[model samples]
Target: MTLPSAMTFLLGGLLLAGSVLSKENPAELAVPRDTTGKSQWVANHYKRMMALADKSPEKFRIVFVGDSITKKWLDDSGSLWADNFGSEDSPFYALNLGVPGDRTDHVLYRLKAKEDGGLGNLDNPAIQPEVIVLMIGTNNLFPPHDAEQIAGGIGAVAKRLKDLRPDSKLIICSVIPSNSAQKDEELVIPANATLSALAESMGDDVRYLDLFSPFLDGQGKKNTECYEDGLHLNEKGYEVWFSELMPMLKETLGLATEN
Candidate 1:
C-alpha cells in the first residue's frame, strides 16, 4: 500500500520534533540523544516494522540503517525504492531502520535490545536481517568532531552491528558528499578514507562502497542537481545513489549480474 502524503508529512514533523527535543531533554539521558522519544509516531514506525517481521520473519532480508538519508526512502514520490524493492516478486525484502538525525552512536543505540537501551529487541532471533546497509557519521562532522572522531564513531557502530547481528553482511557506505560552503570535502574525504579502512579491517563480512565520488562535480563539489539542499539529496540524488548501490546489492545477494 502506498503511504499517504499527509501521513508522511505528519510523521516527518514528529521525527523532526523528536530529534530536536531529544537533544536537550534531561529524560533522554539514558538513551541516545538522537532517538530519545516515545511519541506515537515513533512507536508507530517501530510497530509497523515489528508487524512486518511478525508476518514473515524469514522474508525480511535487508535493512537500511542510518539517518534521514535512509529514512527518506519512504517518500511517496520516490520510485527508486519501489522499482527495486517494493514488489512482492522481488528477491529482497527490506526494512528501513533509519531515524532522522541519527549519528553512529544513535544507530548503535537503536540496534540494541530494550534491555540495553535500544528499540530493536534484536535479542529476538526472528528480527535478524540478512544484510544491513549502514551509512552515517555525516552529522557528527558538524562541530567539535574531527574526521578521526567521526570515523571512530562509525567504527564503533560497525563493531556493535557485528556483535549484535553476527550473521548479517554489512555494506558500509562512504558518507555522501555535501554542498556545504565550509569545505565539506576536508571532513568527508578523510572520514570516508577511514571508513574504507574500517570496512577492510572488518574482514569479508563488511564491504565498503564509495558513494561520494558519484555525487561530486568536475570541481570536486557536490553536484547541485543531485541535492535539494547542501546536505540532503533530492529525488534525482536518490536515483543516482540507487544506481550506484543496486549492483553491489545484487552481487551481495548472489543474484545474476544482469539487472
Candidate 2:
C-alpha cells in the first residue's frame, strides 16, 4: 500500500498545514464537544492520520491511544520514540492516536467510525493494527463524574475498540497516579481498581498494565521526579514508561526480546 512519491509529498504538505494550525491554538486540537462534528483542528488531525494510514508503505502494527500522556511520547519525548520505533527496517510501525484532554467518552466517540469519528478507517484489513495500547479515564476524574462513571466510560471504549478491531490485542493501562489525585484516594484508587478489573474480565484479548506503583512512592504519593506538572510525564517518567512498556509489547507481539 505504498503511495506514489508525488502523493506522499502532497500528503506531507497537508499534514504540515494541519500541524501548523493545531499549534497556533493548541486548545482547539483536543477532543471536540461533538465527535460527529469535530472542530477544524480535530478534523485536520484525523484526516492527516487517515492519509498516513492509507499511504504508508509499512503496516501499522502498534498503536498508542490516550490523552496528553500518550501525545507527550511524540512531542516532549520524541527522542524516546526514535529510540524505540524509529527504525524503518523494523516490522513494527506505531501510531499515536492521542488527543490532549481526552476523557474516556471522547475516546469512545473517536472510535465510532459509523459516525465519522475514531481511527476506524484503519480497521480496513490492509492497515489494521496488531496491538492497541489504551490509557484513558484520568481526565474523567476531574469533577462531577464518579469512579463508576469513569470506569463505565473506559469499559465502553474497550468494548468499542474490540468490536472495531477484534483481532488486535488490547492493552488497557491503569490511570497513573497524579499529584493532585494522590490524596483523593476515593476517586483515583477506585477508578484504577475498576479499570484493572475490567481488563481481567475481558478475557485473553485484553491485558491490563498497572503503571501506578512505578509512578508512586511507598506513601502512595506521586513521585514528583517523574512529572513536570502534577499530571504530565517528564522525560524520566517516559523512560520508566518505555522500559515497562517494551517488555509487554515484546511479549504480546511475540517480537524478539533482544533489542
Candidate 3:
C-alpha cells in the first residue's frame, strides 16, 4: 500500500519548496521606495503653507518664530517666557509660530505673505505683530547650508520684518546649546555669532540676546541632561531662558514683575 521511494522523495521536496517560498519575499514588496518619495513630497508641501499665513494677520501682539526650539517654548510651564510676555493683563497678544526643523527661509516666506497679501487682505483685517522674538539656524546647520549662510538668511528676514512691521520690536536669540556630548562646537559658535551680528545690525528696534553661556560649561559643550537630546531643552533649560529673558521683557513692555 506504501508509495514508491522516488514518489515519497518528490513529495517531500515539494513541501520544502513551499515552506521556503513562504519564508521569502521580494525586497521591493517589503519596502516600497514610493513611500519615501511620497513622504518627502508631503514635507515639501507642508513647508509651503506658512507663506499663506504670512500675508494674513490675526492681530498678534507678540509672535515667536523659529524651529523646534521656539516651539518647545510653548511646552514650557504656564509661567514660561511666553506667559511672561504678552498676556491679557498685558495688551500684547502673544503667538507662537514655530515649526519643527524650519529654517529662516520659512520665516521669510511667512512674513512676506502675511504682510503683503494673505490674511492682511483689506477685507480680513490681519493684526500686525508689535514684537517678534526670532530664533533659527539650527536646522539649516545639519543640511545644505552652513552657519554663515543660515545667518545671512536670518539677516534678510530681519530686514524684511523691519520693513514690513516698522514699529515692531525684534529680539534675536542665540541658538540654545544642545545637550550633545561630542559638541559640534564649530558649527554652534559660528551660527550663534552670525545671528547675534545680524540682530545688532538692525540697530535700535532690534536686540540680540545670547543665552548659550548659561547652558554650557566653560568648555562650551552642551549640558545634555538639560535637554531631551543635546538639541532641545527641558524644564530646567526653559527656566534658565526665562531668567535671562525677564529683564528684556520688563523693559520692552515697561512692567515690573508681579508679587
How does each model score on TM-score? 0.79, 0.78, 0.68
Off by over 4 Å in 3: 1-59, 76-87, 114-125, 179-183, 257-259
Q: How far in Å is the alpha carbon of 43 misplaced in model 2? A: 3.5
lDDT of 2 at 189: 74
lDDT of 2 by residue, 1-259 (tens): 4579889999999999999875442211224444355455666666766665566624678878888898788777748886666455555568777777778766765666644754464455665778899988777766536666667777788887788788989998888886566434766678778888888898897998888888976786788888888889989999988877878888899988876
Residues 1-259, model 3: lDDT tens digits: 3579888899999999999986542211111112155457534533443443444356456767777787777675446644654454545556666667666665555555544543221122264666777777666565535556656766776676677667778888887765433334656677678777777766877998887777876676666656766578788877877777767765676667654
Error of 3 at 179 (Å): 5.7
Off by over 4 Å in 2: 1-40, 114-123, 182-184
lDDT tens string, model 1, 130-237? Answer: 788888877776653667767777778788778888989999988888656454666778888988988998999899999989998899777998887777888988
- TM-score of model 1 vs. true structure: 0.79
**Model 2 lDDT on a 0 to 1 scale:** 0.74
Note each model's CA RMSD in angstroms.
14.3, 15.7, 16.3
